[model samples]
Each structure stands twice: as structure tokens, then as C-alpha cells.
Target chain A: MKPFGRVVICGVGLIGGSFALALKARGLVREVVGIGRTTASLERARELGVIDRFATDWATALDGAELVLLAMPVGQMLGVMQAMAPHLGPDTLVTDAGSTKRDVIEAIYSNLKSHLEQVVPAHPIAGAEKSGPDAARADLYAGRKVVITPLSENRPEAVARVREAWAATGASLHDMSPQEHDRVFAAVSHLPHLLAFALVHEIAGRANAEQLFGFAAGGFRDFTRIASSHPEMWRDISVANRHALLAELDTYITELAWIRALLSQGDGDSLLKLFSEARDAREAWLAGRFDA
Target chain B: MKPFGRVVICGVGLIGGSFALALKARGLVREVVGIGRTTASLERARELGVIDRFATDWATALDGAELVLLAMPVGQMLGVMQAMAPHLGPDTLVTDAGSTKRDVIEAIYSNLKSHLEQVVPAHPIAGAEKSGPDAARADLYAGRKVVITPLSENRPEAVARVREAWAATGASLHDMSPQEHDRVFAAVSHLPHLLAFALVHEIAGRANAEQLFGFAAGGFRDFTRIASSHPEMWRDISVANRHALLAELDTYITELAWIRALLSQGDGDSLLKLFSEARDAREAWLAGRFDA
Candidate 1:
């Protein structure tokens, strides 16, 4: 396959750096340019061979780039899009690795109105608790799922180009409306992250938190592992997808209330039945993933 | 050290079977007699060498036994205590491996009033998502924490004997009042289990549950891992630790509500601050455990 002539990655953090490395490893892009505010990070990324070159300004990197990946926090997407709009080539394909798609799509349409057909909103469903260029891996997206929520104004060829680019990273791609994407991710990802954060906060607020934590074992560790994820990134995601996330929060709170009632009422039989169903569902999910 | 002459283990399942294996591996017990309602499980226990002999009745198992370990579901402790009361030797040292302490202590007092000084209540903070004699391991309790909540009526010798037995398995022991044990565990263990169950139930109840689950990756798996735990065991724990668990749940619910309000109000700064605090605390906890 012919490689993209020049690709600019705007954030140069975990996702962006990983994407650069994956593309380089697969020889899918001719030149990779990393753009970020952190000079040290860009220097490290260049030294790690995650990018062919580095730029502090997106405008400089946007020049002559055939592809651009916006991999920053969701809150910064609009500003970056607006800043790069005037410099983007007419044929440049723009896509993002943002967790939320609806707001990103709206930002593209509002900021890059003339280049609306060039934008593709995407989210690679893969990451770790750690962040930064140093954490990037060439296989970060291998065998992972990527959802592409192409805007209505996006040209079919633009969407195909974005899909093909992600495919080169070995990620399987799926398409959904931005609304559908937000709703699904809100239920599965965002809501769980919030719950993990809330759980850790609750434990920390206790008077005997240190002692209680001393006795906590593997279960508590695994359950709260995601609570160690990047707070700024999660905050942006939670705020950008606030409506859908709030809906999920309401549903989860209701489920918890039901459990609380069962516990209070001494309804052991009902609690057992509910727990059994949950176990069965989770076990089945595990089996499916392993088998797949 | 001289080993116990004969040790009887009621409910020869995970905890009981593991205790038997640990004792046998350490030469801490001369013989282990397994007692349970399931004849097949008892047969399996004997075949696995988790027990030296198997019996259908506690009376037969308790005969000539110098130590007795009650390792059954919390809900069944009272009944089992009452049934084995008349057969227990006056010199027999009794200890239970139930998760909750208060109710088990009450059961010991009500059913074995005359033998109160011999009873010690304990909880080994170790387990797998699996159960049965098949899950037994000699090192299951190694490096784990075991909290012993001795009753006021329990003799110092009885507590020491119980502590020594657990120490034989390489578990570090801590002494706490039954109330203190319950409160600490409710915050760290029971509440986390309940939240895992609730999260799984919430996801399972969604209309797009299968699709949502398909996208859930490592975070979801880790967070819901305990939901795959034995439902009956968790149900018993939840019910037995209801008062403490309820208090923890309220605190957790309030924390969640605060998060919900932050999301609703689009307060990204506060959400970021809260998430950072939680991440810092969790990271500190992880660092402590790993570095310790």
C-alpha cells in the first residue's frame, strides 16, 4: 500500500506517540511529525524514533501534511482544530483519537467548516493507566477495536482513508453514529471510570483509610486499577460526554440503590440470584473474549 | 513445635481444604478430618489429600480431635455450631474462618456457651474466584493478612493457638475487636464486592449489553473480576456484615452523588481534582504493596 506522504500527530502523548510508532513499524507513513507543547516530550519522542521530526506549532507541522491526527484531551480538540484549520491542505485527512466523538465532530464542523468533508472522528478502544511518549508501543493498537464516527459532511473517501490508516495499525474498525458511540462508551467505559474514582475517593475519605487500605488485597487493587488513569484526560471525557455519562450514572446509582435495599431488607435469596446472574454474565463475557 | 494431635475441619471447601493442606505441608497437624454435607466433595477432599479422612457427620469428625476449624458460609455457622456443640471435646480449641466476626462470635456464645473460652473468630484475607477442594493450595495463605477477632470469653491460650495455626500458613496476623474487624472489612472488602456485583448487574441490564461488553477491555475485566466470585459466599458475607456494609454504601453513594453533581454542573476542575486525589491515593497504595 502507498504510504501517507506526511502525517502530523498533534498531541504526541501516549496515543499519538503509539500511533506514530505503529505506522513507522508498519511502513504505512512516509514521514511522521509530532506536535506538542512539551519540548522535552517531543525531544524524547524523536529520540525514541516515534516521530521523524517534531514541531511546537501545529501550523508548521500542518504544512504539506497529507494526514493529521488530533490525539490531545477532548477539551482541547476545538482549539487545536480552529488553529490548524487555515493551514490544512485541501486534501489533508484529519482524524482524532478522542474518547468522545459527538463533541469532536461538532468541533470539526464548526471550526473547519470549509474542510468539513476532510474530518473523521475516531476513538481507538485501547490504553493503559500510564501516559506519555515513553509509554508508547508499536503494538498498542494491535488486535484492538477502533470506532470511527464519521460526520455527515465527511466525504466517503475521507472516511475510507481514515479507516485504512487505522487498519494499518492492526486494529479492527467499526462505524457508529456519534450519538451511538457516546452512549455505548458512556455505559461501558466512562461510567466505570467514574465509579472507580468514586470508590477510591470514598475509601480515602474514611477515618481509618490507611488501616483499611493496609488490609485490602488483590480484589481491591484490580477493582480500582482504572482510578489511577490520567485525571485530566478523564475529566475532559466526563465533561464532553456529560449528558450520556449522567444517564449512565443515574442507571448505575439506581442499580446500587436496589442492591442497598436488598442488603437492608435481608433479602439474601434475591441478592444471591442477582449476584449469580452478574457472575454468569461476566464469566460469559470473559469466555467470549478468550475464545475470540 | 508439637502439632495438634487431630484436627477436624467442617465444610471442607476452599478455606477448609486450604487450611488442611497448609497444616499438612507444615507438619502442624497430625490428622485432618473433613466434615461436610456433600459426600462427593468430602470424597474429593480425601482424594486430593486435603484431608486424612472424611466423615458425613461433625460428631464423627470431631471425635478425639484436639482442634476444630469451622470454615463454612457465614449463614451456616450458627446451625453448624449448635449441631457440633455436644460432640466437641472440652480441650478442643475452636476457631472459625468466617468473613464476619460479630455474628459468628454470637453464634459461638449461644451454641457453645460452656466452651466459650475455646472459641476464636478469625478471617483469612485470601481467596480465589474459585472454590471447592480442587482449589486448595498449601501456599494459599502465604504473605496474606489474617485478622483474628477474639471474643471476650475466648481464652488467651485459645487465641494464641489460633494465631499459631494461621502463622503456620505464613499469613501475618492482626488482632482487632470484632466491631473493628467488621468496619475495616466492610470498607475494603465487602463494599468492593458489592460494588463489583452492582456494576456487572448494571452492565448486564443494558439493552445493548452484549455489544457494550464486546468493547469492554482490561479495565472492565479487572473491575468486575470479583463479580465472578461465588454468589452464595458473597451473599452470606453481605448479609452478615449488613450494618457495616450499609454505612459504607451510604458513604459511597454520597461520594457518587457528588461526582454526579459535578458532571451535571460541568465542573471539570473539581472532577479533575477529585480524580487526581483518587489516582494519587491508589498509586500510593499500589506502590506501598509492591514496595513492601
Candidate 2:
């Protein structure tokens, strides 16, 4: 694969910073430019060698860029896209690292109507509890999945170029419709995060919270680890994918209510069956992952 | 503390086997006897040197034993207590590794009325995803918390002996009433396990389960890891602590409903507040644990 002449990353956070490092490490781009809201963050990203240069304005950063990766929060993607649409090079390929795809894709089509063919909405399903430049690493996306929702307006070459870029990061690419992507993530990722946050919030509000937390074991720690995620990021995702996420939450609450009823009725046998099926399914999924 | 003359383990699974290993490693027992329903498991425990002798019958295993550890599922505790009541020596100290205390304490009082002074219910808050004798380790209980619920009928010497035994395994011991112990675990441990199981079950039953699991990342894996726990064991705990677990479940469902209403109303500000509070609480709890 030929290296790009110039690559600009918006938002010098974990995902953006990591993509910059990965591209540089693989020699996939000649120059990497970072754009952020704060000079301190951009400076730190430059100091860490995550990017070759920094700019506070996307208009200047995207001027001559061959590719632009919008790694900002979902709530901010629309504004960034609208801002850069005028300055985007005619041949530039644009993509995003937002967790929710439908809203980002819609924002691109509505705001960058003339440049829809250059936009390929992509979400790299990788992150940690920590964020920002310091938490970024070159191998953050290695062996991870990056789902791309290509609109009919996207040129084949443009989608291929974005796929090639993610491939260079060692991430497996999967193409799906925006709706399917939202539904799948809503069930597996978004819903779980919301549940974790809700659980921690409920426990924290209790009068005996300290006692409850003091006796909490490793299971509690692992189960609620995601509760410590970035609040603004998750809030944007939950609101953007509101429909799919709400459906999942309803299903999960119904399941929990069923379990509660079983316990109330002293139906030990049925509870055992429910738990056994779940355990077997989870173990099989783990085994399949290992085999793959 | 002097070493026990003979220690009989009622079940040779993870908890029992690990206890035997910890006792042997600390030289806290002169002889370790393994008892189980299956001869193959008993033989395996003996082959692994987790026990000096093997017996399928607790009657023979309890003979001349100075301490007996009831390390079995909560559902089986009553029957085992009744069966071993006649065989228990007057000077022997009986302690259990049951996760729930109130039910097990009641079982001891009901089944071993004559030997009430010797029984001290205990629970060790340590475990791995794996189980059985093969998973036994000498340091399984190292630095873990073990709660001991001593009854009014229990002799001080018996409670002290049980405490010393757990201390030899490097576990910190705390004394609490059975009701308090059950409520605390119901909130921290049992409710989390049930929620994990419920989440996995809901996803597994979906029509797009394969796609959901395929896209599930590290967050889902950690949040649902406890769903792979022993089904029968969780069922037993859920049923034994039904009242407290049910209360916690209701509280959690209410919390989820609040989140749902916020999402429905597109109240991103409130959602952010809720998630931020949860994130801060979890981070503070983690920091406190490390500092301790």
C-alpha cells in the first residue's frame, strides 16, 4: 500500500492519538496533523510523537490533507463535519471514530451534502477506561474490529481507502448498514454500559454505600468497571442511539423482572435453568473466540 | 496456634480443595481428609495431594477430626449437617464456607441442635472463574476477607479456633451478625452476579445473538464474565437470600427505569449527571481499595 501524503486527526484523545501513532508506526502516512480544542492537549500529543504537527482549527488542518479522521465525540461530530466541509480537499477521504454510526452518517450527509462521496463512517470498537493522549498506544486497535457503514453516496475507491487505512492498524474491518450497526452495538455495548452506570449509581446513592463497597469482591469490580467510563461520551451515545438502546434496556429489565419473580415464587428450578443456559452460552462464546 | 490433629473437608471442590491446600501449605493440620459424593473426585483430590485420605462418607471422615470445614453448596448444607451430626466429636470445631450466612446458620441450628456450640458459619470472599480440585491453590485466600457469623450457642473457643484456622490462610477475619452479612453480600455480590446472568441471558435469547456476541468487546467480556459462574451455586445463593436479593433487584430495576425515562425524554444533561456521579463513585471506591 502507498503511504498517504498527509493525514489529519480531529480530537487528540485516546482513539485519535492511537490512530496517529499506529499510522506513523506503520509508515502508512508521510505527515500526521492533530486538531484539538485545547493547545495543551495538542502540544502534549505532539510531545509524545503521536502527531507531527498540531492545529486548533480543522479548516487549516484539513486544507491539503489526503485523509481526515474525525475522532471527536458523537455530539461534536456534526459541528466538526460542517466546519471542515468547505475546506476538505476534493479527493480527501473522511471517516469518524464515533461509537454511534447512524447520527454521524446522517450528520455527514446533511452537513457535507456535496462531499458525501468522500465520507465513510467508521467506528473502531476499541477503548479503555482511560482517555486522552497519554492513554493512547500504537497497538490499541490491533486485532480489534472496526465496522464501516458505507452510504450509497460513498465512492467505492473512497471506502476502500478508509478500509485500507484501518487495515494498516491491524483491525479487522466489517461492512454493515448503519441501522444494523446501531442495533448490534446497542445490544452488546451500549446497553451494558448503561446498566453498569445505573448499577453503580444506585449503590452509591444508598445510605450504606461505604459498607456495601467495602465488602464488594472482584466480581463486583469487573462487572461495574465500565461505570467509570467518560460520562459525556456515553451520554452522547445513549442519546444518539436512543431508539435501539431503549429497546435493549427494556428487554434487559424484563429479563431481570422474570428472574426476580422466579426468586419471589421460590422457583429455584427455573432460575437454575435460566442461569445454566446463560453460563453455557457465555462459555461457548468465550471458547469460540479463543478458537478463532 | 497449634496445628489441628485432623481436618475433614466435606466437599472436594474449589473452596474445599483450596482450603485443604492452604491448610497443608501453612502446616495447620496434621491430617487432611477429603469427603465427596463421587469417588473419582475424591481420588483426584488425593492424587493432587490436597488430602491425605479420601472418603465418600462423612461419618468415617469426621472420626477423630478436630476441625470440620463444610465447603459445599448452600442447598446441600442442611443434609450434610444432619448426616454428620452424630459423627461430630465434642471438641471438634465446625465451620462452613457457604456464601449465605442466615440460611446456613438456621440450617445448623435445626439439624445439629445438640452440636450448636461447635458450628461457626464463615464465608471467604475469593474465587476464580474455574472450579474443582484442579483449580485449588495455596494462596486462594491470601489477603481475602472472611466473615465469621458466630451464633449465641457457639463457644468462644470454637469461634477462636475457626478464626485462627482462617487466619493461617492469610485471610482477614471480621465478625458480623448473620442478618447483616446476608444483606451486605446481597447488595455487593449476589445482586451483581444475578444482573450479569440476566444480561447474558437476554442477549443470548435475541435473534441476532451471534452478531451481537461477534461485535462484543472487552467491556462486554468483563461485565458478563461472572455469568460463566456455576449455575447451581448462584441459584442456591439467590434462593437462600431471596428476600434481600429480591429487594436489591427491585432497587436496581427502578434505577434502570429512571435512566430509561431520561433517555426517552432526551434529557442528556440529567443522564450526564447520573453517569458522572457513578464514574466518580466507582473511581473513588477503587482508589480506596488500593490505598487500604
Candidate 3:
């Protein structure tokens, strides 16, 4: 496979830096140009070997690049796409690491239609609570799932290129319509984050939460670890994927209501049975009997 | 400190096996006599070095033991206590690893009131999802908190002996009323587990959950890890700690309603600010400022 020359990765934070390292490690890309809002991070990316060079200007990095990765926050991706529009080469393949797809895909279509044919809106289901280049690791995407949301009018070549790039990082790629991707992730990823955030906020607001946390065991720690993630990014995710998020929230609330009714009516048997089934399902999944 | 002549650990599962391992590691017990309902697990415990000897009969294990550790499920602890009362020595230091102190204390007071003074209901706030003897680790209690709920009528010597035993296992001991312990843990531990179970149940009930899980990221996996825990144990927890769990659930529902209102009204700014503060507080806690 011929290596992609002059690849530009905007927003050289954790996802971007890790992607850059993965690309470099697999020899899929050569001469990676990093761009970020902060000079320190770009310098860190260079020092961390995620990029061969750093650029403050998006246009400078995008010029003549065969691959351009928009790794910025979901809210800022639109302006970023517009900023690099003039510099995008005719055949330059662009993709995003945004959690939500419909909005980003719309922004890309609206902002850079000429290059839209060469763009694929994709999300690599990989990350940690930690962020920035310092938290970046080459194996971040290993054994992870990456979803590519392709439009009916999207160039098949562009979609294939994006799939090949993610495959090089040892990720299994799947394709979905933009709407389906948002709706599915809204249930699994976005809603769960909202629930975690809401739970933490609720508990933290309690008068005795500080004291309660003292006795918190492993379960509490594991359940709330993602609650400690970057808020700005999650807030944007919740809003950007609001429709699907709200739908998922409705389902969660319904389930909670049933539990509350059981508890209120002292229906111990049903509550116990509900908890037992869910536990069995999850245990079987963990034990490899069922797919996770 | 002199080693306990013989320590009988009831229910040789995760906590029981862990307790047995810690005692053996510190040379705090001359012999660990494990009693389990299942003969196979007893054999496994002996093989794993979690116990020096094992039997399916609680009476056999409690016969000559100086310390009798009630490490059974909360719901089963009462029946086990009653079953072992025939063989409990007058001077035996009785303690428990039950999470709900109030229930365990009641069980002791009701089932073995004649020797209730020798019982000290304790809850070790450390555990892992991986259950059974195989999951037992000697250092599991290191740096972990253990709460001892001693009533005014309980013997001082009994409390001291239990405290020393847990401390020898490298756990930090704290004192709390049984009521306080239950209330606090409801918020910190029980509520979180219930929420995780409910969330996963809701998602699994959805038409797209199987497909959705295919794109489930690390956040989903981490948040739901506890969902894979033992169902019988968790069901017992929710049933035994019903009042406290209900109270915590009320608080969570109230806060969730407030959040839903905020979202409905499009108050993203306030929501973001609240989330950011929680994120910062949790990050600081993770950095060890919350260590006692």
C-alpha cells in the first residue's frame, strides 16, 4: 500500500494525537502536519512523535494533504471545516472524529461542497477520561469499533479510504446512515454519559454526598468514572445529539419509573427478578457467552 | 497481637475468601475454617490458599473457632447465624462483612441474642465484580475503609477485637451508626448499582440495543461493569436496604426531573456550568484530594 503523503490532523488533542500515532505506526501516512488551537499542544504533539511538524494555521496544514482529520470538538468542527475549505486539495480526503454525525455532515456539506465528495463523516469509538496529546496512545483504537456514516451521494472511494485508514489502526469499521448512527450512539454512548453526568450532579448536590462518597465502593467508582470526563465535549454531544438523547432518556425514565413503583409498593420479588435478569445478561456478556 | 486460634469464615465467596486471605497473609489467624453452602467452592477456597480448611457445614467450621466471620449474603446471614448458633463458642468474636449493617445487626440480635454482646456488625467497603475464591486477593483491603457499627449495649472488647482484625488486614476502620451507614451507602453504592442495572435494562429492551452495543465505547463498558456483578447479592442488597435505597432514589429522581426541565427549557449554559464544576470536583478527587 502506498503511504498517504502530507496528512493534516486538526485539533491535535487525545483523539487526533492517537490517530496520528496509529497512522505513523502503521506507515499509512508520511509527513503528518498537526494543527491545534494552542501552540503548547502542537509542540507537545511534535515532542510526543504524533506529528512530524506543527502548524497554527489550518490552511497551511491542509495544503496538499491527501488526508485531513477534523478532530476538533463537535461544536467547533463547522468553523474548522469552513476555515480549511479554501486550502483543501481537489482529491483531499477529509473526515471527522465527532461523536454526532448529522450536524457535522450537514456542516461539511454546507461549508465545503466541492470537497464534500471526498469527505466521510466518521467516529472512532475510542477515548479515555483523560484528554490532550499527553494522554494520547498509539493503541487507543486497537480492538475498538469505528463507525462511518455515509450519505447516499457520498463518493464510495472516499468512504473506502476512511475505512482503510481506521482498519490500519486495528479497528473494525462499520457503515451506517448518518441518522441511524446518531440514534444508535445516542442510546449507547451519549445517553449513558448524560445519565452519568446527571447522577454525579444529583449526588454532588446532596447535603451528605461528600460524606457518602467516603463509603463509596468499587461499583460507584466504575459507574461514575466517565462522569469525570471533559464537560464541554459532553455538553456539546448532549445538545448536538439532543433528539436521540432525549428519546433514550425517555426510555430510561420509564424504566426508572417501573423500579420506583416496585419499590414504593414493596414489590421485592419483581424488583429482585428485574435486577437478576439484567445482572445475568451482563454477566453472560462479560463471561463471553454473549457478545458485548 | 496474638493470632486468633481459629477463624471461621462463613460463605467463602469474594468477600469471605478475601477476608480469609488477608487473615492468612498477616498471620493474624492460626487457621482459617471456611464454611460454604457449596462443597466445590470450599475445595476451591482451600486450593486457592484462601482458607486452611473448609467444609460445607457451618457447625463444623464454627465448632472451635475463636472468631466467627459472617460473610454471607445479607438475606442469608440471619439463617446462617441461627444455624451456627448451636456451635458458637461463648467467647467467639462474631463480626460480619454484610453491607447493610442494620439488617445484619438485627439478625444477630434476633437469632443469637444470648451471645449478641460478642457480635460486632461491620461492613468492609472494598470488593470486586470477580467473585468466588478465584478473585480473592490478600491486599484487597489495603487502603480501603471498613465501617463498624457498634451499639451502646455491644461489648467494648468485641468491638476492639473486630477493629484490630480488620486493621491487621490493612484496612482503615471508621465508626458509624447502622442507620447512618445504610443511608450513606444507599447514595454511594446501592443507588449507583440500581441506576446501572436500570440503564442497561432500558437499552437492552430497545429494538436497536444489540446493534447499538456493537458501537458501545469504553464509557458504556466501564459504566456498566458493575451490571455484571452477582444478581443474587445485588437483589438482596436492594431488598434489604429498601428504605435507604428508596430515599436515595427519590433524590436522584428529583434531580433528574430538574435536569429534564433544564433541557426542555433549553438552559444549556446552566447545565454546562453545573457539569463543569462536577467534572472539576471529580477530577480533583481522582487526583487524591478526597483521600481520608
**Which number leads on TM-score?**
2
What residue runs in model 2 are displaced by over 4 Å at the alpha carbon?
Answer: A289-292, B289-292
Model 3 stretches with alpha carbons more than 4 Å out? A287-292, B55-59
| Model 1 regions lying over 4 Å from their true place | A289-292, B289-292
Fraction of the real A/B interface contacts present in each candidate? 0.72, 0.77, 0.60
Query: lDDT tens digits, residues B129-148, model 3?
Result: 77888988888899999998
Candidate 2 backbone collisions, by pair:
none
Q: What is the DockQ of candidate 3?
A: 0.61
lDDT of 1 at A68: 93
lDDT (tens digit, per residue) of candidate 1 on A129-235: 98999899999999999998888888999998899999988899988989989998898789889989998887887777789889989889888989999999999
DockQ list for all candidates: 0.65, 0.70, 0.61
Q: How far does residue B220 in candidate 3 sit from its true spot (Å)?
A: 1.2
Candidates in descending TM-score order: 2, 1, 3
Model 2, position A9, has a per-residue lDDT of: 91
User: In candidate 2, what are the lDDT values of residues B180-251, reduced to their tens digit?
Assistant: 999999998999999999988888888777888899899999999999888988999999999999988988
- How many residue pairs clash (N, CA or C atoms closer than 3 angstroms) in each of the candidate models, in the order given? 0, 0, 0
Model 1 chain B weakest 10-residue run by lDDT: B283-292
